[model samples]
Target: MTFVVGPVSVRTPASSANLGPGFDALGLALSLHDDLTAEVLESKGDERLEITVTGEGAEDVPRSGDHLVVRAMNATFDLLGERPAGLRLTCVNAIPHGRGLGSSAAAIVGGIVLARALVDGGADRLDDRAAFQLAVDLEGHPDNVAAAMFGGLTIAWIDGAAAEMQRLETTVETTVFVPPEAVSTERARGLLPETVPHRDAALNAGRAALLIAALTVAPEHLISATEDRIHQSYRAGAMPESYKLLRQLRVEGIPTIISGAGPTVLSFARGIAERAPQGWAVHELAVDVEGALVR
Candidate 1:
């Protein structure tokens, strides 16, 4: 795998994982995206990596090889047994950071797909399954990465030593309510209990299955399907506002769930118009059918 072209561009969509009962198993890609461009530097054998980021977390994100996108790209090159001379990377980000919108997953997928394009000299060589496994290997989880790689609604799980994903079709439109505050995925995960009652575990299993049915065939069961007993209430202290908003929305008969780790709420309300509470931003996003694209 070698590249005659100097630059390659890739775009990846934002994703929401752990939809209600699924908990590290389910995710969906949204219409929001981030664009990244990778170019091989002219200086030969320099081995330097330069990254320029604009929009979103530009002020705080790294501008070197330590950047998530650059790391992913490097991982791809390592896997392909090819070394480029140097790299210049530019990122145009639109997804909000720490909002449970899979910003990191998008960056990882974008970089990997960028490498796939560059390795083939601007031609695509990575297939869907290969991309899913590579992203999962880098991310250590399949939920967010699966949606970002395959698009639509994805159910991802570990099969022995390998990761597997299946995409499902959903007709419901999604609305995400993002609060101004950010919730760290690490902190939110730390709040979960090490063990739960057997009954609660059984209930979650049932709900997860029903959630899939609600998303695919029976739309009316969505409310009951979104019921969860595993992680949400346990992490209430970290996102009181999101928990309160979720309760209020459910009371009003809206099928809403905490997006990914929380601090962002996702509602499958289709065309319904509902008012957002004060101090929250609302975005109406469709399910992205296409995951990542190269140009």
Candidate 2:
């Protein structure tokens, strides 16, 4: 297939995963976004990918084929059995990297959406399921990718090689306290025990179910709904400050959890300013209704 479209732009929202008890099953999309623009260049006989990045991680992110966004676009082209002639990509990113806020997922979704828009001639050819699967294939999980693609609250699960997701409505206000330092997802996962006790697993299962209901229907149960025994406690040693902050917030009767793999903490409480500790940047972000958008 010949590349026929002009310039295509895509915006994808940042995401938080786990939400305490759900552990790779639940995710929420935030208002923070990363914007990407892709234009098919008139072939100059140079096939090298060109990427210009501004905002977060601009100094470190790749400008070549190794870039995550470029890889995603290439994956889309491979999926369609067509090779991109040549392209120029511009990225304006706002989501912070490695703070448990789905920056990588946003990049992958943004690139896929950009490619889909260009290929479909401004139409959104990448539906929710297709986007979820493609992103999962790249990201190795569904939670963050699902939220970035579908927006709002997403319940994601993998079945064999396929991924599934359902979006849920949420009216709860949220506040995230991001520390200056970052803890890589790999480092945090390394802190978790290989096996959890059966009782803890059962307790977390109940809370996870309640959390879904509280976010969608029973908002009053949020305080109890956010309790977890799965990943958070096991990973507390990785980010002791974040863990301590979470404990303090819960003691004050607020529903809080380590946002994804953490170093950043998320609170379901609205008045978080008074509760937030020193040396943390607090952001009040709403649920992003439109996930990855092609414009």
Error of model 1, residue 117, in angstroms? 0.7
Put down candidate 2 lDDT per residue, 1-295, tens digits, no spaces. 5566588888899999999899999999999999999988756686757789999889889889999999998898787667677888999999989899999999998888787776754234556567668889999989999999889999999888899989999977899999888899999999888899999999999999999999999988998999998799888888999999999999988899999999899999776676667877788999998999877
Candidate 1, 1-295: lDDT as tens digits: 5765777788899999988999999999999999999887646667778788899899989887789998898888887778688888899998889999999999999988888777764234566677678889998889999999888999999999789989998867888988898999999999999999999899999999999999889989999899889999999999998999888888989988999998898898855445577877788999998888876
Task: Quote the lDDT for 231 in model 2.
Answer: 90
RMSD in order of candidates: 1.8, 1.6
- C-alpha lDDT (0 to 100) for residue 190 of candidate 1: 98
Clashing pairs in 2: none
The lDDT, on a scale of 0 to 1, for candidate 2 is 0.88
TM-score of each: 0.94, 0.95
Clashing pairs in 1: none
Residue 192, candidate 2: alpha-carbon lDDT: 88
Question: Candidate 2, TM-score vs. the true structure?
Answer: 0.95
